[model samples]
Target: MSLLEHLEELRRRLIHSVIYLVVGFFVAYGFHEKIYQLMQAPITFALKKHNLPTQLVIHNPVDGFNMYLKISFMVGCIVAAPLILYQVWLFISPGLYKNEKRYVMPFMVATITLFLSGAFFGYRWVFPGSLDFLFAYSHEFRPLIEVNEYTDLFLTVILGLGISFELPILVLFLSLFGIVSPKFLWKNIKFAILIVFIIAAIITPTPDPLTMCVFAAPLLFLYLLSIGVSFMVHPARRKRLKEAA
Candidate 1:
């Protein structure tokens, strides 16, 4: 395709993705209250465990409403993720061979599964543990967990992990395009470990080594998985295996 045609196609995909997100936003807005409750649950549990008040405080009157809108938007992104991924695939499909295009289903499935798994891990273990660690200090002072601030931290942990879990998928694309090979990835594994730990340190709410390890563990696993994925999808390896078959 010409450059102009490629640009037009990208525009079309963007429009479709935006429309899907808007629809998802409205749907999520309808259940925004429930979503807020779910988001607030970890903090509530932590406060209870610490024998503190379970309510999250809001200094400004509009903070509650703003949080509601933010929650809706985030949930909208989750709802629209599959459609947005599909739009992305469609945009890139023209460059792939027929056999490669057949991976669309697996790609979508793996992307969604890995993202949800990471989000769930953060919500179930990392977030609650961090909240407990933070709230442990409330023994000396009254805790006033602000709604907006809490929401920001919550999203940072959850969405950050979700996006991070897409490492294998990212590597798959790089290998498919012949940008990297399994040997290169393996050779650089030490560097990848260093980078992963750095990111875990940055993102983990707690300063403890245990919490940081909990955050970094899955990311390291995903990096290893990416190496394997590269081996499978790298053009030279795939072609050699096909010829042997």
Candidate 2:
């Protein structure tokens, strides 16, 4: 395709993606109350466990509405993830070989699964642990969590981990495009470890060592996994395997 044609195709894909997101947002907004309760559960659990008041404070009347909108938007993103990924595949497929195009299903499945895994990990373990540790560490102080602040923190942990878990997928694309290889990833393992820990420390809400390690450990594992992903997707490896077959 010419440069103009490619640009136009990209614009079309972006428009489709936006439409999917908007539809998902409207659908999620209908259940915003339920979504809010689900999000609030962690803080509520922490507050109750600490024997503190379970209510979140809001300085302004609009805070509650805004919080709900944020929650709905997040849910909308989750719902739209598959379609967005498909659009991504459509955008890039023309650049891929026929054999590579066959990976579309696995790519979509892996991307969604990995993202949800990361988000669930944050919700199920990291976020609650951080909240518990924070409240316990500040046991003497009267705690008043604001609605918008809490919502921001909640989304940060959830979305940050979700995006971070796409490490393997990122590596897959880089390998498939001949940009990186398994050997390079393996050789640079030390640097990857350092970068992973740095990202973990930055994203981890709590300043605790344990929480940081919890965040770093999976990322390190994923980096190792991404090396294997690189090996599998790297053009040379794929070409060699096909010739052998």
Clashing pairs in 1: none
Residue lDDT tens for model 2, 194-222:
99989999889999888999999999999
lDDT of each: 0.93, 0.93
For candidate 1, report its TM-score: 0.97
TM-score of every prediction relative to native: 0.97, 0.97
Off by over 4 Å in 1: 241-245
What is candidate 1's lDDT per residue for 141-203, written digit by digit as tens?
898789999999999999999999999999998998999999999999999999999999999
